[model samples]
Target chain A: MKKLFQIALGIIAAIGGFVDIGELVFDTQAGADFRFQLLWAVPVGVLGIVVFAEMTGRVAAVSGRPVFDVVRMRMGLNVGLITLAASLLINLITLAAEVGGAAIVLQLLFDLNVSTLILLSVVCLVLVVYFVPFGGIERIFGYLGCALLVYVAAAVHLKPNWHEVGQGFVPHLPSSALYAYFVIGVIGAALVPYEVYFYSSGAIEDRWGTADLNLNRANAALGFGLGGILSIALIVVAGEVFFDPHIQPGYLGTTALGAQQAFGEAGLVLALVGMLFAVGGAAVECAFSGAYTLAQFAGWEWGKYRRPRDASRFTMAWLIFFALAFVIVETGVDPVLLTEYAVILSVVALPLTYLPLLLIARDRTFMGDHANGILGNVLGWLYFVIILGVSLAAIPLMLITNGGSV
Target chain B: MEDKQMDLVYRVLDDQLVDIEGRRCGRVDDLEFDGSLGDPPRLYAILSGSGTWHRRLPRPLRKLGERIFGTGVSGRDVIRVPWEQVEEISSVIRLKAKARDLGLGQGDERDAALVAKLPKS
Candidate 1:
């Protein structure tokens, strides 16, 4: 029963922690525009993340070093510095978007000003980071964010045609540049670089070792698999309610309306609460990812398991990040637009973050008997090619489609 | 130990260094070697810290790094762990000495001191 509870907690955290402001925005937008045509991208992105995340967690558990540490060692100082700069920039933008996202959710729930809400959100996050243990933070946000599962129930209640939903899974390429843009956006949103950084570091924080290898695999598979289901649920709900209405879902409030359309007041409440926790959880993830990348690259003491005084530089990095994000959001940029830009930019930088993990994971010196198996190598290289292709095409498609406004 | 030979670049350089207590010191940023040009070089010392890392860059960037880190041309800031101090070489380089005791963590100590001064919430 104890082991079952542990697995259950891990899965819940992954599912709830999976959908952030970017996934919420892109999945709904994709559903609205393509009406389930782009659903194929969700699993592709989910599996891509799982493959690398498992490798990262395995490397951390077996080697006792996080992914970024391996990245610095493999890429060397100069190239690693370049990668670090790009990742930090993307993390900052993503963090700002998430803070803005949580603020918007609060504003929707309370009819409060967004600026005040942003300030409140930043304060709350800092306090939580300071006061709560890492495990506590994960469980609180994870369970609360499960409220988003309401989307799945709402999708089921709407009873869409089973044939069309199944057809959505078979990959079909639409000729429109806009469809291509959404495809890239949906995939990028699913496999954000920070997820691997956070997961690997989280493994270390949780004190995982060789014994936890199966736990890592199970967590990545079941947790992220369920996350894929939630993404698909968002797309399905949008298809049923917003497609015919021609709603673009340009706001968090608009995404919440899908729940209301399906189940009225109860759905609206659950959706808002779930979104608040999910986006709040993302804000924490991005902030810590930024800190972890910097600290691990510099070989500084890091991990939420350490006391604040012990990991001072790491703590300072995240605190400074949150303050900067609050300032950005206070400038009043639309959080949804920021989410789109962050996702696209991160996709462009994905190869730099992931390639090193693939290399080091396969290096027998690091893994001993636990190195990448035959299946791991096959899928790792396959995703490497796919990621490279998408990365090269991302900027051109975004430019051509004008951020999918076309 | 002398019979066990491995590629230093692949096995030693860039790997993390952990001290006797299992605390991370840093990565193997660079290395020092001894012997004449014609003879096979022997590992002499393990170089670490930002100074050594900065020196690995191209000339202009190395200058910029020196300016930012305030490292001098003599490279006094680099922490040199004598090769004999390495107790084991595996996934990570294990050092026989404590990192703090070796005067290798001045920057970290300073940061901790500053953070300690901040009021607890």
Candidate 2:
């Protein structure tokens, strides 16, 4: 019973930590634009995250090397450097977007100035990271982030057509460029590289070994599976409340209004609170992921398990990233718009991130018996191809759609 | 036979380097070998630092990376861990000396000194 409870908590934390500013923005916008038509992309992307996360998580647990370390070892110095540069840039932008999004949510809830709140958010996140133990940060944010379940409740309460909702699961060729853009957006948002970097590194920090392989699978499957359900709920709620072509949700506040339409003032407050913790959690992950990648690649000692004083460069990297993120967001860019670009641009980094993990996970020398099984190999390569295609289309689609505005 | 058996590029180069106390020091950024061209070169040392790794890049990026990171160590831009110090090479390259004794992680130490001056906890 105790073991089951611990596993349940792990899965719940995973689920809570899954959705970030990118998923919230893209899922909500995709739903408002195409209703249930884009729903197929959520599960597709969720399954992709599960497959890759499970593989990479296993690699971390078995070998004690995280994603970036594998990138350097397998991809070599030149290609590894390029990948590191690309991922770090994307991580920075995503970090800024999450921090900005969290500030916006705080502004909505407390009616405070966004600039001031942005500073506050970064400070609090730094403090949380400094003072909170690794598991504490995960559980605190994860448990509170479950507040996003209000979207699931709102989706059902709005009472959409069940038949149409079911049909959304069946894939269809998007008839227009806008539809195609959202398709890429939803997938890209879900498959952001930071999640893998953070998760694999977290596995190492938690001291996962061969014994934790099943636990890794459970966390990836159930945690991400439930998070995908919340993403679908976001789309469903937006589809019902803002189905009109004119009612596009451009702001984080407008997205929360979907819940307001269902449960009024109380619902709005809950949605805002959920957004606070979820987006804040994402901001924390982004900062840590960036630090992890840098420290891991440079072969510096890193892990929140160590005191900040103990892991000096690693500590400095995250602190500097948070400061940089604050500067980027303070330029008055719309957090939602910044995240849209971050999501789309992130697709370009997806292939580079997943390819090394796929190669290393299948190697018997590295993984021993825990190497990718037949099923794992097939799914891993299949998603690699899909991610490659999505990356190829990502930039051109962004250009043609003007960041998916059309 | 040992040289033929172990794929240095696969197993040694770029693997994490852990000191005797099990603290992570750096990576095997480059390797040094002893012997003339016609003779069979034997592994001599494990080279680590931004300088050594950046040298593997194309010249243009190499210059830029050097400019950004500045070679390494005491103007050499890398620290050398003699092949003799290697305790084992498995998932990580475990060394038999302390990181300080190996001259690895000088940058980390320097930066750590600066970080120590800040208010922590």
Candidate 3:
């Protein structure tokens, strides 16, 4: 049971990184627009993240260092600094969107003032980070974020055509620029760089040595695989509920309406509560990820296990991130729109983020007996090539498709 | 010294620096050597902190880093731990003493003190 609970780290990383406010709506939008045609991207993304996260987690456990440390040591200062700068930029934008996302969720729940709820949510988040232990934070958010599984129930309740749902799993050539954009967006959203940063750091925070290799694998495969399942359920729900060509699942409330259609008020309540924790978890993930990258690069003491005074700069960095995110959201930018831009920027940063991990994980001098075996190498290099290709196409698609508008 | 067997750039440079107590201090941002032109340059000391590492940046970014992070040390702006103090050369460079005793981790200590002043931190 204790070992099973260890998967919470993966759950939080996956649910928070892959199914956050931005992704929840983004997946729904894909379903509403392209229906099941984009379903293939979810599993493709799930497999990609699992492969990299397993390698990254193993690297951390065996080497006694995090991903950024390898990045700096192998890539050297020039390349390392470039990675750091790009990561921090995308991290800040994503953090801001999450803050706005959580605030919007709270306003939906209580009918309170959006700005006031924003401040209130930030204060609560600060206090939670300060007071809660790392494991406690994971359990609270990781388990509650499962409230989003209400979408699975809703999808089943709607009883979509089983044949059509299965067919969605098969990839199709893009019929239009907009279809291509959603395909990449679905895959890229699942492979967001912050997920690995948060995942690998969380492994260290949990103190897993080589003895915990099996645990790391379980966490990576099951936790993220569960997230992929939720992504599919969400798309199925949106496709079934919002089938009309005139309708668009553009807002969080509209996304929740799918659940409402399935089970009425109780389903709606569950979806909102689920979103509240999932998006809230993403806010925490981004803040910690930003701080972890900086601290690891600079070689400062870091980890939530340390007192605030112990990892001083790390503590300060997360605090400043929350404050800056609050300021960004207070500008009244739409959280969903901000999330779209953040996802695109994250895809652009993906190759830079994963390259060092791949290099070190495969290096015999570093990983020794645990270096990438045949399967890991084949998958890692294959995904690396795909990421490079998608990364090159990401910006151009966003411009041509005008952020996935049909 | 039998330095020919070791690849300093790949094995040592930019690796993590940890003190005896297993606390991370910084990275080997730069290195110093001692010898004349014809003599094989022997590794002399390990340079750490923003003060020395910033030099690796392009001239413009170096100046920008200096402006933003400041030279990490006062006066010469270099914190050098003699090569003799490195206890091990594995994934990390383990040191023979505490970071504070070696004039390292000053920023961490200073920031920690400031954080101590905050309420409920």
lDDT of candidate 2 over A169-258, digit per residue (tens): 999998999999999999988898899999999999999999888899899999998899999999999999998755989988898999
Candidate 2 docking classification: medium
> Which scores greater on TM-score, model 1 or model 2?
2
Quick one: best DockQ, which candidate? Answer: 3
The segments of candidate 3 whose C-alpha lies over 4 angstroms from its true place after superposition are A1-18, B1-4, B59-62, B69-77, B119-121
Output the chain A TM-score of model 1: 0.99
DockQ of every predicted complex: 0.53, 0.73, 0.74
Per-residue C-alpha lDDT of model 1 across residues A1-406, encoded as one tens digit per residue: 8877898899999999999998999999999998889899999999999998899999999988797888887888888988999999999999999999999999998998888999999999999988898999988888899999999998999999879999999998767989989998999999999888999999999999999998999999999888889999999999998999898898778999889988999999999999999999999999999999988887777888877777778888999999999999999999998998999998999999889999988988689899998999999999999899899989999899989888
What DockQ does candidate 2 have relative to the true complex?
A: 0.73
Pick by DockQ: 2 or 3, better one: 3
- Which ten contiguous residues of candidate 1 chain A have the minimum total lDDT? A299-308
Alpha-carbon error at A315 in model 1, in Å?
1.2
Give lDDT per model, in order.
0.88, 0.90, 0.85
**What is the iRMSD of the candidate numbered 3?**
1.2
